[model samples]
Target: MEKTDFDTLIERSKNIRTAYHQLELQHHGSKWTIEEDTLAFLTDAGLVGRNTMSQQGRWPKTETDAELKHKLGECVWWLTVIADRMNIDIKDAVEHFLTKTENLLEK
Candidate 1:
């Protein structure tokens, strides 16, 4: 397949979300609240409970390297949808964020 642009990915993500929503509606379900969806998205991405280290005093028993990798991909998909919905150029947004962070770290 050919490579796709950020805008294309965003459009595709919207389509996927629409289909997911339709399935929920068909099953007499409700849309996920923003918070719920966000949590769900993060959990699915393996970024929630799979922390490599425990902040409270111990290391995590379960390894999450694979889960974290998968979740990062999912996060990119979610981000594309959000950026598209907001009419933002995700590519530019990412660049701007990186640039800002780099400049801040240089201080």
Candidate 2:
């Protein structure tokens, strides 16, 4: 069977993160702990919110649409990595969330 898109994303994200960990080990003496990674994800999530506000004209238009789009993608990549680090399967988690939400909304 062919791999799903989500499966491909998980694999690629893990590979990229592994490469970054190697660089961090060489330069910083250690890879970041999961807590540090979660903090980084939160930081990016904040940027996504700020850029979204800029796009919506709620804030000063300091960022371009391309920059906002890049941040949005980065947030997804961060979520995948964070989930993997926590021993959660991101694809399954998303599926469960969607299914549960849909069922709730159907009532």
lDDT of each: 0.69, 0.90
Output the TM-score of candidate 2: 0.91
Could you estimate the TM-score for every candidate?
Answer: 0.61, 0.91
Q: For model 1, what is the alpha-carbon lDDT of residue 94?
A: 92
Expressed as tens digits, the lDDT of each residue in 47-105 for candidate 1 is: 53344343333555555666656666678877776565567788899999999999999
Clash numbers, per candidate = 1, 0
In candidate 2, what are the lDDT values of residues 1-107, reduced to their tens digit?
45558878889899999999999999999999999998998998898888889889999886558888888888889899999999998989999999999999999
TM-score of 1: 0.61
- Count residue pairs with overlapping backbones in model 2: 0
Candidate 1 wrongly placed segments (more than 4 Å): 47-70, 82-92
Model 2: colliding residue pairs: none
